[model samples]
Target: MKWTIYQLLVMIGVTFFMWGMENINNENLIAQPPGEWTAVNSPLLTFLATGLLITGFYFIFLFEVKKKKNRFQHPVWIYMPQLCMAIGGVSFVLFLIGGTIGPLGGWVEQMRSLLYLILAYFLFLIFLFIFSFEHKRNRSAQATEKTIHLTFFWTLMLFFGLFFLF
Candidate 1:
């Protein structure tokens, strides 16, 4: 599919909106060190990164789908994000285990924060995968099935993540 500049811009805007909401929640505030200026964490960064990932995959999947091609010979550059996603998932689980079973107090608190960040990364990857898959599939016939799968996956992940967060 040919993507117009307008479509890309719209996707960027949507990504920024989603990322901003995720990163800038007031409830998760952390205090800065004395005499240090607090930096604003824009969730927009996460959104933009995620959006780019989804856009790339969408373009690849669209090209393949439109051409009716199913060759699985993905190049190294195409697989890099998937590798990063796997690393992020493993790191998240490790952080959760280390935080819960390894220590107490400050160390655990720090680990918990790190775990949350990793969870956010994992969620972003999940969104990228789902959005790409949905864009590739026959929307009318498989929409419900795909939605159910994504909902279940996200629900399970969010439940476990929240359990670790609090």
Candidate 2:
């Protein structure tokens, strides 16, 4: 994909925004010690992070569908895995990066928690239904969907596993 100055700026802005949000403390209503400012227990952060994730993925989904000439008429189930995988993979990377060298260091313990399992389940269902879709003779649509689905799954899995090695 071609990178434009505007897109790069927006991404940088989002990264900073996420970093700022991750550092917000909803408890105590006051500042903590210099090194204790990380607030991994804030529910607001969790909800905000989830909302941002969904919104980002929604825009990406729309762009992908429009770019690839795919319609939104596909069953909702066909999209769930793709959605969850995108969200989960993004969340994992953000948290992983933040925990390693940013404010989310406090979230390291929760990094590989139950959410990953749930995402994995959705990913599994995506593969299972990949072969079950009745695309009939619309080979292009079938190929497109299959390509998108497999690409998302494998790419996420590969990077996720790689990140855990260090």
Candidate 3:
């Protein structure tokens, strides 16, 4: 079954939704009391998770652009997702740096929260990107696209949820 670009985009959108939901829930869990939930105390793990999430989104953007035959040139807004990913990555790195320096508790936590919010915006961009890219597509490809989209979405959410929640 040949897949239309729209079908692929829908799959991506569904993925973003699923991932965002998981992320929100996970973040909530992490914000809970320390004794009740085993928070990730290791800075290395925090940094790694943030880096990987940013990297994964970046790859997704690159792959979509390449797959679309450079059609991304149409509008300037199309690049927003990649930009958000970059911002999140930078913010996370800054949080890591601040955390290591000591006496920067306020700065580190602020940076971390900012990064999380930006990551949420990135998910919105992902949704838009998929919608814009999938204006016209065949139905036959929808099933496969849906499966992959859901898989990636849930996987990302689970990974981030685990990292953020406990």
Candidate number with greatest lDDT? 3
| Model 2: per-residue Cα lDDT over 19-94, one tens digit each | 5543453234544556565545444544455444433333344344444344444666455546656766776687
Q: Which candidate, 1 or 2, would have the higher TM-score against the true structure?
A: 2
lDDT of 3 by residue, 1-166 (tens): 1224544665576456546645665576445555665544454545464545544554454455445354444554445446656666776676567657754577536545544545545554444444333422322445324533553555456556766675
Which residue ranges in model 1 land beyond 4 Å of their true spot?
1-41, 71-166
Number of the top-ranking candidate, with TM-score as the measure:
2
lDDT of 3: 0.50
Instruction: Please give the distance, in angstroms, between residue 40's alpha carbon in candidate 2 and its true position after superposition.
Output: 5.2
lDDT of 1 by residue, 1-166 (tens): 2434444655566456545554654356644457756444433443454444444434433444334233422344345446656766786676677657765336636544443344455655665455444334534556433543553455445545654574
TM-score of each: 0.30, 0.32, 0.29
The CA lDDT of each predicted structure is 0.49, 0.46, 0.50
By TM-score, the better pick of 1 and 3 is 1
Q: Each model's number of backbone clashes?
A: 1, 0, 1
Report the C-alpha displacement of residue 8, candidate 2, in angstroms: 5.6
Model 1: how far is 110 from its true place, Å? 18
* Cα lDDT for residue 110, candidate 2: 58
TM-score of the candidate numbered 1?
Answer: 0.30
For model 2, the stretches where C-alpha displacement exceeds 4 angstroms are 1-13, 25-41, 68-166
Report how far off residue 30 is in candidate 3 (Å).
12
Clashing pairs for predicted structure model 2, backbone only: none
